[model samples]
Target chain A: MIWQFDLFILVLLVITALVALKVRDLLSAAMIFSIYSLLMCLLWAEMGAVDVAFTEAAVGAGLSTVFLIATILRTTRRTTD
Target chain B: MSDVLTFIISRFNYWIYIVLMMIGLYAMIAKRNYVKKFIGMSIFQTAIILFYVSTGVKSGATIPILEHGHDIGHAAAAINPDHYANPLPHVLMLTAIVVGVATLGVALAVVQKVHDQYETIEEPEILFKLGQE
Candidate 1:
C-alpha cells in the first residue's frame, strides 16, 4: 500500500516536470514547478523526514512559486518560439 | 509477489529523485527565459534536499530528544538505535532552505532590474535591444 503511494507520487513528479517543460506560458510552468515541489515534499514525508519535508513544502512550493510568478508578471506575457 | 514488489519499490525512490534532478537541470540549461531558469534551479535544489532527507530515514526510530527521567545508558538501549534518524541531513536542509530563499530573492531582484532597463522580460528581446543601442 505504502509502496504504491510512493510510486504514485513519483509518477506525479515526472508528469509535472514534463508539463512544466511543455507549457508555453511562463506562469503555467512556474505553477507546475510548484506542484512538482509539493509532490516532492510528500515523497520526503513518506521517507520519514518530516522536518525536511516541511521546509521543502514551504520554501519550494510557497516562496519560490511566488517569486517566479512575480518575475513573470514583470516580464512579457508571451514566450517567443 | 507482494514481498518482491515492496523490495523493489523501497529501493527505487533515490533513483526517481536523480531523474527529476536531471530533468530540472536540463530545463535550466535549455530554457531561454530567466524566470524559468530560476524555477528549474529551485526544482534542482529541492531534488537534492529530497535525496539527503531520504538517507536519514530509519524504521521505528523515535525523535532524538532524551526521554523524561531516563539516564543515557538506559535510553540508549531502550531506544532502537538502528532506526534512529541522522540529524545531519535535517540540519543541512535548514541551511539549504535559507540559501535557496536568498538566491531566489537576488535572482528576482535582478530580473526586475532587467525588466526596468530593457522594457521587456524576454531574454532575446533584451539582447536585441542592447545590440541595437
Candidate 2:
C-alpha cells in the first residue's frame, strides 16, 4: 500500500486549503484553490480513479481558475473580512 | 500501542476527508465574502465526490475496462467481477463535475452582478447599501 504517499498529499491539500481560506488577497486565494484542485487530482489518480482525476485537473485546475480570475478582473481585488 | 497506530493509519483517509468537509462547512456558515463562500462550496462538493469514489475502491482490482483482445460481451464470461474496479461512482462523478463547473459559472455571474449593482461583494456592506437605498 502506498498509503504514505496518499497521506502526504492529503496533508498538502489541507494546508493549501487552509491557506486559501485564510489569505487576504483574492488573487492568492484563487491561485491557491487551483493548487488545491491539482493536489486533489493527484490524490484521485493515486487511488486509480483516472477519470475523476482528469476532470478535476481540467476543471478545477484550469477552467474554474480562469473563471475566477475573469470575475476578479471584473471587480475589485481586495476582499473585506 | 502499535494497534492504535495501525487503526489510525488504516482509517486515516476517511478521517482526513471528514476534516476537509468540516473546513468547507465552517467556511460556508461563517465566511463573509460571497466568493469565499463559493470557494467553500466547491471544497464541500469535492469532499462528497471523494467520499463516493473512496467507497468504490476494491483492492487488487484493475481498471473497469475490457482487457486487450477481449471484445465486449464475448469476454464477459471469462472475466471475474472482482477483477474490475467499480465504475458506477466514476460515471456519477463525471456528471457531478460538470454540474459543479456550471454552478460555479452561474454563481460567479451572480457575484459580478451583485458587485455591479451594489459596488460591494461583502454581505454586511451590501446589506447596508441596500438598506440605505
Highest lDDT: give the candidate number: 2
In terms of docking quality, how is candidate 1 classified?
Answer: medium
Clashes of 1: 0
Query: Per-residue lDDT for B1-133 in model 1, tens only?
Result: 9999888766787778888899879878887777767777877887787778767767666444445535666666676456556667877887897798789889888989988888876678788998999
Fraction of the native A-B contacts that model 2 recovers: 0.48
Off by over 4 Å in 1: B1-11, B60-77
Candidate 1 per-residue C-alpha lDDT over A1-81 given as tens digits, one digit per residue, 9 for 90 to 100: 167887899889888987887788888888888888888878777766677778878887898888887788877656752
Best by TM-score: 2
Model 1 sits at a Cα RMSD from the real structure of 3.8
Q: Candidate 2 residues B1-133, lDDT tens each? A: 9999999878998999998999899888888998888888889889889888877778888667768545667775787868777889988997898899899999999999999998988988998988887
Instruction: Please give each candidate's TM-score.
Output: 0.83, 0.92
